[model samples]
Target chain A: MSQCLHQVAGPVWNLGRLNHVAIAVPDLGKAAAFYKDVLGAQVSEAVPLPEHGVSVVFVDLGNTKVELLHPLGKDSPIAGFLQKNKAGGMHHICIEVDNIKAALMDLKNKRIRSLSDEAKIGAHGKPVVFLHPKDCGGVLVELEEA
Target chain B: MSQCLHQVAGPVWNLGRLNHVAIAVPDLGKAAAFYKDVLGAQVSEAVPLPEHGVSVVFVDLGNTKVELLHPLGKDSPIAGFLQKNKAGGMHHICIEVDNIKAALMDLKNKRIRSLSDEAKIGAHGKPVVFLHPKDCGGVLVELEEA
Candidate 1:
């Protein structure tokens, strides 16, 4: 089915590298320790993103990264997710796109819904939009402009 | 804490790249279509691994891959996971390691538990071991030999 679609017309925007995998952790310090001290990965200090309602720590794997997220304020976005997933879990995967607008337009045409109509400035200060998990095989996917 | 640990002694094994983020999907075809057609990713055909009790479709995002897994046999390891995550969800993240034996030994010394005492041949025909989710901040982690 995808072969036929690919043969007809090429993709509007190129899907680049996987930016990072976000993990919402109940204990940010413990999670950071596990990745750094235990796994021997280069881990960054927790940066509080108050506007985003979470504190993030980047676990750099040299190729890609794992973003460790923890609830920051009262309206932390990951708070509810932590409630359901007590110990912490893989929250979302962010993939880079050559053009965010083109990707969103193409996805919308294909009946793929985005969480928002327009791309917003993400943690990296890049234009990003999240796709609806229900339409994305039940996995929360974030598309960031590369 | 990690800085202090690093100052004391170097890690036993090196942590390599982020291998793949595994997603357990209820419908393999739909998930594959979403990645190949909708997202315009280079996706491989579903390969059934009866021994592994799952069918895997690799969505290549250039730098890293997203592994879509579906149960192949009755006693599939992902069966219980899919039952809980009815709409499907992120299952585990596999990270490449330079030495599996040394990594296991080091993790054991740190009181981090693996699912098994010994590493087993994984889907990629490489030595792999799954770390206990409880000890790894509730996220199932697979360490694959690079």
Candidate 2:
């Protein structure tokens, strides 16, 4: 199995397609409008993800999506980010994968850390897990089930 | 020409496929090794882009690319980013466009500001322009000719 390991190790597991690039914005409405009215992009209705502590809107890019996230509550996760950066910025990126559990197992086996203990339902309504930003060169990487 | 304007305004510019997501790294070799050895990603040989003041390597993700950028000179654009983020992080994303000039014109007409007056040859060997981060909700966006 070492040869199989070697081949898979050339590029282990499936690094699937990029699902979306998430951007955190101070004002969801204004950001969405900027893309829609100015850039002529199709902006989706804002959906509140209370569990995730953010309200999100998707700007359809035809090929991919630009997700706009805003803090939903006083203790929202994005509140700290907004506090540090008055203006919004790119938050995280989601990459599609075949199996969340398998991916997690593989990453753990490689000593890669996951932000959470287990997978959770993400904005796409799919099982997802976040990799530690430190482990991902400061970029928050999210793996979602395809 | 109002009808023509309307046609162009309906997402007139084509937002082609995402070319690559660039991540600024403190140590290019270490970052490349992390992706290659740990993540099992096939990492390309690092190439120095003297004009851009950085050394870069691409990690093929099958669907897209992850570009690792390391500062090569004192005035490298990514130097300041790394100074603030000692651990390094996602820098900017490059999206493919059909006509760089046309896309710039469209963005300019809509009041979107580009970081430069003209397109420059980017690491991908394509004409590219970076949009002002403030104008793009704080995300530095690179538009490259398809």
Best by TM-score: 1
Counted clashes in each candidate structure: 0, 0
lDDT of 2 by residue, B46-92 (tens): 99999889999988876678899999977999999999999988888
- Give per-residue CA lDDT, model 1, range B12-127, as digits (tens): 68899999999999999999999998888999999999999999999999899999999998899999999999999999999999999888877876789999999999999999
Per-residue lDDT, model 1, residue A90, is: 93
What's the C-alpha lDDT at position A28 in model 2?
87
Each candidate: what lDDT? 0.93, 0.82
DockQ (C-alpha) of model 2? 0.49
Scanning candidate 2 chain B in windows of ten residues, the lowest lDDT window is B6-15
Off by over 4 Å in 1: A1-11, B1-11
Q: lDDT, candidate 1, residue B64? A: 91
Q: Which candidate's lDDT is highest?
A: 1
Off by over 4 Å in 2: A1-13, B1-12
